[model samples]
Target: MKPTDTQRLLRRMFDAAIAAAQPALCVPPLLPPAPKGRLVVIGAGKASAAMARAVEQHWPGPLSGLVVTRYGYAVPCERIEIVEAAHPVPDAAGEKAAARLLQTVQGLGADDLVLCLISGGGSALLPLPLPGLTLADLQALNQALLASGASITEMNCVRRHLSAIQGGRLAAACHPARVLNLLLSDVPGDDPIDIASGPTVPDPTTCADALAILRRYRIRVPPTALAWLESGDGESLKPGDLRLPLIDTHFIATPQRALEAAAAVARQAGLHAHILGDAIEGEARDVAKALAGIALQTVRRGQPFQSPCVLLSGGETTVTLKGQGRGGRNVEFLLALAVALRGEPGIHALAGDTDGVDGQEEIAGALIGPDTLDRAWALGLNPRERLDANDGHGFFEALGDAVITGPTLTNVNDFRAIVIDGPPTEAP
Candidate 1:
């Protein structure tokens, strides 16, 4: 295929993947029956506001509540209040919104219904620190964890224990109300507890587990926080907790579903699509290297599958931030993939976050092809040095290869595709 065709094809697959996970498409069908009593909606994440809007559009009964999403992600919702907050880190707005969410579910009867919309980035958007632990403490802890390369599960375990409303605490607060949780899965494995720290569900992890993760990462906590953990006072509500109300959870969107949607797009273009996995996770560079090896093998021998195929995968990856440059794990993965490919013929790749933001930047991710390294060399850019500095954003942006999709209003983790072609036929 031509270079422009390759880029366009890859982007089409990405758009399809994101469309499959949109709240409007995923939420309405799964909404529960209208309750006899009040229906209160509460949520937190990059997708929660949109999910709340979906609820408002579908529900037949009167429903009113609140949801907090990352800034620039809010959609129009009439009954349910949509609040914007900082994501990947907690802020004052998120703290206030979280407190209000807990109160919104209070004083409810068993007949009342609580619709909890949860998704990726919810952990940071619902930062109601446990008693004696301040929001600043959560902020510093989140910063450390982001840089520590801790898995999403580990980071959320700590978040669940340290927060007043995470884990099953929010559900417990709605003692007599029935909670119908609609979750958008962005973490690997689609574990409910890891999605927004499982605010409306029970936590299977313990305070001891959170403490161990903190120590494993060498992350120090406030003295008060430490004392609280040691005292077991910050322990999250666990399974079989009697205080929790009647709760039903559903995953409206997941990585596997998104990958399948992307795969369908590739197949429609007469390319064989293979879904490698949906829950792959590791260091960004490490994952890139491994995937590059597979792509090279497919190109050279076609052992796994024939050429003219697209290998697609989805999952969140970590980047241990060591450089002072702009860092996003998706960009980091793409840059590493480019270096590993070393301008191999008939190979093109794209890696991006479905949420339309990679790391702290608005850019989604980037694209790479056989001429990627040569193009960099033409501009006197050292790809290796940029990779070493975790400056994937800078490197790709300079090449004008950065993919920008503003506020996709959804999160199903990362999407990666490697396209390989068959060798050209000799002139007949």
Candidate 2:
């Protein structure tokens, strides 16, 4: 069966994401040859399990450790145990796994080696609440932050302050040991500290900044958390810290690399590809509106790249949930973009999470074409109402346009493509 253009483009995008996240493709062979003492592997993220498996396959020496991944994202490993946990929200399973990981890393000698696999969603997968704070407190704050449309950096900043094993504290616990972090960045800026809340990386955000985030979002943190933030007692590991001297962090996968891969795929498809910044952040709808304006210009005036081109972008987008319907930022962005386009012909678009889930829903994201608005009207669905109710998933699902890939096992972040066919004169 011949695949549609949209299908081909989406497959290319997914392939790019996978290529950028592959552990074997990213892990170095000569990584400070096996230490004389024990080699312990510890990590948490959507991609950590796969990364850990890759490490074991490549390392010449026997290794043992644990890594926590989102449920259904686990890959079989012979030595390193893969634990499944919740994502975008913390659960008791994740909490226990995080506690155990901390215990496993403690008291390592200078001769020992610690390989840490860090990736997106580690913040929630490794949920160890600070002293005097309950898991419920962290859960509540997480829910609030997700709904608040806070950027990943802001959310992670708040999480680091409230967690027992985040923000460089994890690395500090492995004192005297050689720590090497293999990171897959899902955050917009690919900041090592922001990914997975920087479990092993030095945190540059301050407690005051975390408190400001809480205030900005009106999130109710625990009294203990509040006091810690107010007192500025729990500072994260800083640069030049003696304990950090032996730690090395390597970014294995990033949004930029993923975008470039997607761009390459577009070029292969005989379409000119333009990659916008890979670190874009803001409210989803606003970003969609801005992108829609640019896309319109490219289609109408031929200003950007010309016809038969695809504008590809990657990063995490935010959505402030005000409605009761299911919605992911990618879908929300598409919905807003569709509304703005108002059925402009000869343009098709796809936006989705590389992890194959969007905003707690099973759908990755949705696709939009020139007929999207018309099709919705035919189905008697009001696109504006759905967008107003934060029902992007619902709207797309009704049209059978929602793409469901079911846990791709890797997460770089949101992948978006705006395909503009030839000018209006080239219409069939």
Candidate 3:
């Protein structure tokens, strides 16, 4: 399909963001030294399979391993087995993979190396429910969390406390073995424990904290899960546990780095690139309002940043569901931005998840320009109503403006770019 200049630029920026975090490029250098005994690799996330492939290419000795990734994100590896599983919800495939991953790490000698490749979506991809908690129980809680507009930090705290593998229990399973955790940061603040719910790192959040967060969101977790948390029976490995001392973690890819990559590309295109933040978190529409305000200021008043500049930011934004429309946080943000901008010229923007899937849909995100709302109105769609309905996916799809990249195989979280071409004469 022929794309407008704005669409082309927006896509270029998104591609650059994803490129910066490719496993082949970022994993080689972060490889921990090989151990004296057998090398057993274990991981979970959308990027773990690719990370496993990178590890297979670099390590000097033979390696045997198992890692689980979101379905359709698996990459081929020589000796490491890549298991495909559901994401954002627990499924039987993930449940089985979790058991196999735990089994793979068992019986590792003190000198053996256990490599854990973790990234976004790992929390749901590794679904080993605590004793007496069914996969359906975890699934219900995950759905509630998704609808609650809870931050990733709060949601992960609950996940860690409820799961058997999450919250460093997997690392603890490798007890005497040395654990090298390679992580890709997708959450705000880049807290290692929050990434994929910290399956390999010591958890600092307590069971009480998880219970409180669930209550704050008004999410009704399974009775068994709630009971375990309240009793501290589902508590994860603490900071000073003996099993965690041999664990070393590395943050290989991050939202900040992805934003910087897009910024570099913008600079090369002869536009001043301003990175507002790499960890801005809030409601999707709320964040869009802020971005639109900044973009309009740059266009009308030349404050914060001059024209012919691109503003970049990255982070996960939550959606508090009030409607039944299929909504992705990125698309919702763009739709809200378009509404607030009132079809302002010289400002174009795009927001997409780096994993190539925005929310639960296969579509990544959508791009918006001066005519976005005009087109929507002409198509008999009410922009404000659609926004309120959380139907950004439908709104953009009708305009034939949705960006679909299938599976990106790696995730660093959301990637956003707001391009302001300045005054009328120089606008692109």
Q: Quantify all predictions' global Cα lDDT against the true fold.
A: 0.92, 0.86, 0.89
Q: Please list the residue runs of candidate 3 whose C-alpha ends up more than 4 Å from where it truly belongs after superposition.
A: 424-428
**What digit string (tens of lDDT, one per residue) describes model 3 on residues 182-279?**
99889988999999899888988899999899888888877788789989999999899887649888889999999999988888888999999989
* Comparing 2 and 3 on lDDT, the stronger one: 3
Candidate 3, lDDT over the whole model: 0.89
- Highest-scoring model, lDDT: 1
Ranked by TM-score, the better of candidates 1 and 2 is 1
Q: Which pairs in model 2 have colliding backbones?
A: none
lDDT of 2 by residue, 1-428 (tens): 23467666866776676677666677655355888999999999988888888888888887889999999899999999999999888999999999999899888899899999888889999899878888889999899999998998899999998888998888988988989888888888788989899989888789999988889888887788899889987677777777763888788878888888888888888888899888888999999999998888888878766878888888889999998878699999999999999998777889988888899988888888888998899999999999999999999888888888887767888988898886734222
Sorting all predicted structures by lDDT, with the top scorer first, yields 1, 3, 2
Decoy 3 TM-score against native: 0.97
